[model samples]
Target: MTRSLKKGPFVDYHLLKKVRSSDVLNKRIIKTWSRRSMIIPEMIGFTFAVHNGKNFIPVFVTENMVGHKLGEFSPTRVFKGHSGDKNSKNLKGSKNVVRKK
Candidate 1:
């Protein structure tokens, strides 16, 4: 049986369903950030929002360190070169994703 959309614009109905159940969508978001060469499994955060459109609603969010970087930007933010601060050392001595309480 096909899944049903809860409510929203028709265009977003499709997109939201794709976002909700598609590993491909999730991986694409992750890879886009990774391609920009950001650190991961760090102190980045997650957020979700419901976008109501003319036709349907879409669930939108950000994930990983990329989210933190995006959030750090200010309207007057200026870009200097990367700090060259590779926190990769944090990965040493620990498993990739440690389940915390």
Candidate 2:
């Protein structure tokens, strides 16, 4: 769900304060766990280390990312394989010629 239009985008209070105080050119790398926070226009060109459960993922903000959640850029789950069980047989149909009696 999106935030209320009247309240505006929901940005982290601490993150907003830091962004406001620092110079645009000397952008401070921000590490945050608040993935629900929205990317504001002021955040463009800034680098953010967004937490994705295990580690922090570096994200460089751009104009295109505005109004989106910081979490959208960070991935939580990783899909390694389609196999359901490790101990289960992977091959359904295969030749067993070597076992011929």
| Top model number, lDDT | 2
- Tens-place lDDT digits, model 2, residues 20-92: 8877688668889989899999999999999999999999999999989999999999988796765447445
| Residue pairs with backbone overlap in model 2 | none
| lDDT by residue for model 1 (1-101), tens | 32254641122233344344555334343212111122223212322222222222222233533323222321223478677546675766667857779
Residue pairs whose backbone atoms clash in candidate 1: 8-56, 8-57, 9-55, 9-56, 9-57, 10-55
Measured with C-alpha atoms, the lDDT of residue 91 in candidate 2 is 45
Weakest ten-residue segment in model 2 by summed lDDT: 91-100
lDDT (C-alpha) at residue 61 in model 1: 38
Best by TM-score: 2
